[model samples]
Target: MTLTSIPIALTIAGSDSGGGAGIQADLRTFAFHRVHGASAITCVTAQNTLGVSRVDALPSAAVAAQIQAVVQDIGVQAAKTGMLLNQEIIATVSEQVAACKIVNLVVDPVMVSRTGAQLIDDSAIAVLRSHLIPQAAILTPNRYEAQLLSGLEILTLEDMQAASEKIFELGAKSVLVKGGGMSGELRGVDVWFDGNACETLTTQVVNTPHTHGTGCTLSAAIAANLALGKDLRSAVHLAKSYVTTALKYSLAIGKGQGPVGHFFPLLLSDS
Candidate 1:
C-alpha cells in the first residue's frame, strides 16, 4: 500500500501523569486515526483513576512557545484545546492559534466535571468564553459546562437543543452539548448546532464505570478526523462512533475509574 505523508493534529491541553486523559488521551486518539500528534501542554496533574491530587500549570510563555514550535515546523492541520488552566494560558493559546491561523480548532470546554464540580475559576471561564471559545470551529461542552456557557439549565433534550443554540451565539462556528453527564434516555446522546441546523447524535450506550478520558478522547478524535480531511459533521459522527466503541472495551485499571480503551482494536486482535 502506497501511503501519503501523515497528517498532523495538535493538542493544546494539560498532562495527566496516570496516562488516562489530557494530552495522553489526545495523542492516543490521534494515533488511532493514523494522524501524527503534536502537543502544547498547559498544565500537569498528578492523578490516577481515583482523582487528582496535585496540579501545576506551566507558564503561559512556555505554552505559547510550544505551540509556536509545533506550528512553525510540523504544521498542524487541526487542533483541540483541553484543560487550559487559567486566563493567561487561555489568552496566550487564543493569540497563538490566531497567529498560527489554525482554522480547524476544537474547543472542549473542560470547566466542570461529570459530578457538577467546577474545575476552573469564574474569571478563567470568562476569558475562555470571551476569547478562546469565539475562535473555535467547534465547541464541545458537557452538561454542566453547557449550562454555564448557555446560562440555562439543561434538563431535557429540548433544553440541550436550546443550550446548543444559545452557546452558538457566543461566536463558535458550531456547538456540541455532550450528554455524557445526563441521565435516563438522554445519556450518551449529543446535541449539535451549527447556526443552520440542530441535530441530536446518538450511539449505543456502553454501560461502564470506567469512562475516564472520554471527553478528551472525543474532542481529540474529532480533531484527528478533521486533520484527515473530513468535513465537520462527518468528523463528529465518526468521532462519536470511535468513542462509543472504545467505551465498550474500557479498561478496568487502577483502583477507581479507568480510561476507555483507546487502542481497542489492538486489544481485540491480541485476544
Candidate 2:
C-alpha cells in the first residue's frame, strides 16, 4: 500500500459554539479539500444562528503559543485567519507571521456577523487595515465588510469593483469582495482584484438560509487548494464552487439560520 502526504493548513480564528462558522467551518472546509487543518483560536463566541451574543477573546500570549506550537512542529503550507477581533491578537499574529514566514495567507476580515452583531471593535479597524491586510496574500471581505473597509457603499457590481480597488490600496495585495449580502439577483457574484485586473467569479445564488460560515469556508477552502499546489485563481474558483455546493445541500438546523452541510456530498439523501 502507498501512502501520500497531506499538506497542512492553519486557521487562526474564533470558535463558534454552533459548529457553523469560524474555526469549525475552517476545519471542515480543509477536510473537504483533503488538507490537514491546524487551528489557533483567537476567541470563543457564544451564540447560534440567531446572532452572536458574546465573545471572549483569548490572551495574546496564548494565541501566540498555539501558532508557535503548530509552526514549530506540525507546520503549515498556507494559513487563513477569521475573526481576529482585537488589536493585541492581530498584532501578536503579525509578529508571528514575521517570525514564521508562512506563505499563502488568506485573511477573512470578519468584522461583523451575518446577523449584524459586531465581531470586531471599531477602533481595531485601523489595526486590521494597517497590519493584517498587508500581511495577507489575499483578503476576502463580504459586501458589508468591503464597505466597512473601503468606506464605500457597494450597491452595484461597479461599487464592488471600486471597493476591491480601495481595499487593495489599503494594503491587501489581492482582494475578493463577496457579493452574497448584496440585495438583488447578483447570483452571489464575487469580485477579485489582483492589484492589476479585476476577475469576476459568479455562481448562481443558492436559495438556502443555511449561509453561515460561507466566508470562513471560502477562505479555508482557498487555503486547502493552495496547500495542494494550485495557484491563486484556481484556488479561488474551486473554493467558490465548493462553498456553493455546500450551501446547496445545507441542513436547516437552527431556528434563525442553520448551517451549510460541510459533508453534504457524502450525505445519503431520501431521493
Query: For residues 109-128, could you state the per-residue lDDT of candidate 2 as single tens digits?
Result: 88865444666787677788
For model 1 the local lDDT of residue 15 reads: 99
TM-scores of the candidates in the order shown: 0.98, 0.95
- Candidate 1: worst-modelled 10 consecutive residues by lDDT: 1-10
List the global CA lDDT of all models: 0.96, 0.88
Q: What's the TM for model 2? A: 0.95
Tell me how candidate 2 scores on lDDT. 0.88
Which regions of candidate 1 are displaced past 4 Å?
1-4
